[model samples]
Target: MTDQPVTYSADSRLASIWSAAAASWLPPITLILAIVVAWEAAVRIFSISSFIIPAPTEVAKSLVAQWDTLMQATLVTAGEILFGFVVSVVVGIAIALIIVRFDWLGRALYPLVVLFQNVPKVALAPIFILWFGYGLAPKIGLILVIAFFPVTLSMLAGMKSVDHSLLLLMNSVGASRTQILFRILVPHSLPSLMAGTKIAATLSVIGAIVGEFAGASDGLGYIIQFASTQLDTALVFAALLLVSVLGVAFYYAAEILERIVVPWRPKFNDA
Candidate 1:
């Protein structure tokens, strides 16, 4: 009546909102909630013993009740992961630089790198525990081993991916090696490095847990082992949940850092 186009109907607006919400999170949330409900129902309906498989509610209760202990274990695990991850980044970058700097070194050592990378980190867990002793050292060492290869490989690939024309342009300008590396090579490699960091973050947690499982007196890995031995299924679930949260949190933290550092990376309109 006012000569303006009609607005969307209430139903249409509601549907639009619902669609957006669903697009944002409903699928994953529904799936997770459904799984939890199913898990709880299965345990109750089958009369499963808590010692065998705990209900989700029971695990949540256990987590709440054992908050202090779980928190301490979580802190220890986080410390180990952080230390290991830092070490891996430093060592990985150093190795990548050496390989990229010297062609002879790359040719000579790349095969060994591939060979070691192929070897499962779990296989070396025991050896690391043996060498570093049954302490945080072994756990951190294994974390370093697990995370380092991916970072090194990703960085090397990134460095090599620099455009030939760009390289030539830098050379034409007689740019110093350090200047070219800092301005062009590093920026070009940032996306790859972030991807590698995310993978490394997850693997570092696994490595720390495996090392601790081998032999350790503290941390989430130790808590999991202790829970298993006592048949505390709820506690085991609690530990696993904590580990999952840790991995996700670390991954997203890396992603945030990547976004902050690499503004050139494309941002989606939806995002």
Candidate 2:
């Protein structure tokens, strides 16, 4: 009798990958479907008015009916989110670097940063609208304010938490401050930065909506406001659904970017 090693064929490997992917997604999808079903049943049994609490089906119908308007608003909101998030990343990283490089600056500015973060973002939204008017600028500014802290804090923590032994080794090698920062600290900080960026991405959406709510003629937030005025609860629900989808989509996009940039880092499942 001879013994043979078992090996997976290419098709088998692909099938396994697909199965794993499906298994990972199935539970969440099932839960969402169950909730929708229950919601539909409850609305029908209670004879609920669409003006009060629209069923998922009504929301879906509203989505289709208002697709054009929703898409235009979505584009506007998405642009604000992307632009604001980018600004937040650049400014956050620069601030992080400055604070890390200067002990005095870090000591002086860190407290102010924490204090600023403690301020209610919603309160600031109206002020931003007042300053920047009912334009994209205010929404972008609000998003930047809301999204900035997480990335900055993450980066600072990451840079500060680098192994002291590594710093010592770099010192032994006579590595310059810039070299140590670029080669060691920045790389070490990427994982934390990405984590913060994911959070910031979601927050940016909320910030934009808040700004729109404060003062805007367009965007999902405006749609929600208008729908409420019209008592079109289905439209409100539809817009809310779109916003939720947008936030999740943005979050996953950041996650994908993180994976691309930090390929060496373990994935969420692995961790």
Candidate 3:
């Protein structure tokens, strides 16, 4: 008289998974398409000058026409962002570890870190260019400076947030400081680290652009600046679109890495 248990077939399970994925992606895609359509329509209906605001079609055409130049600029910017982000991750994590391991160091340095972060990053760009010259070094330096704070702060918070009870339990077991740090603190801090990484990724792009704006012969920021002088609004929009795409790509790449590294945690949106 027991009821039979329900079981989903493999095909049905896959179909359900795909259905859920589609449901998640559909709204955003649809909205973007609608916006593009509206934008195109508005420009046409109002006879808006492309110099003022390029239509989506005009932007798309410019993107294709200038693909070579745009791609090279994008690559220059991407390289700066990638290098800067890597340096930030390494240096930030190292600083966080030192801060957590040494109370005196944390007390001595954390305030300075916060104060430096509060300083206008844009102002520093000029100084960096002056010191490092108008080369990739300055751009990478700017990105590192801009991206470093978030990761360090997030890791510090995560390390400090570790449950005292857990620490006591580990201590009772005679766990060494290194073991406790590796086994507990680092694992617990992953979510916060990933969160900071996502922020850093977006900021890295901004820092690169700012550096380029201050002084650069290449990169998307340079392209935008050059186009502005010519009043080539469509090219400006096209370059901007590339920057937006790069930022989104960098963000999602970090998200994917977080998922791979910390599979136990829920996806960011889910949480």
Q: Which candidate gets the maximum TM-score versus the true structure? A: 2
lDDT, candidate 3, equals 0.91
In candidate 1, which residue pairs get closer than 3 Å at backbone N, Cα or C atoms, i.e. clash? none
- How big is the positional error of residue 237 in model 2, measured in Å on the Cα after superposition? 0.6
| Ranking according to TM-score, highest score first | 2, 3, 1
Note the residue pairs that clash in candidate 2: none
Q: Can you write out model 1's per-residue Cα lDDT over 1-271, one digit (the tens) per residue?
A: 5898556788987887778877978789999999999999999999999999999999999999999999999999999988898888888877887777777997888888888898888988889878989877888889988999988899888988998999999999899877887798877888888778888888888988998899899999999999999999899999999999999988888788878877878645223
TM-score of each predicted structure versus truth: 0.88, 0.93, 0.92
What overall lDDT, based on C-alpha atoms, would model 2 receive against the true structure?
A: 0.92
Sorted by lDDT (best first), the order is 2, 3, 1
lDDT, each prediction: 0.87, 0.92, 0.91
Best-fitting candidate, measured by lDDT? 2
TM-score of 2: 0.93
Tens digits of lDDT, candidate 3, 142-177: 998899999999988888799999999999999998
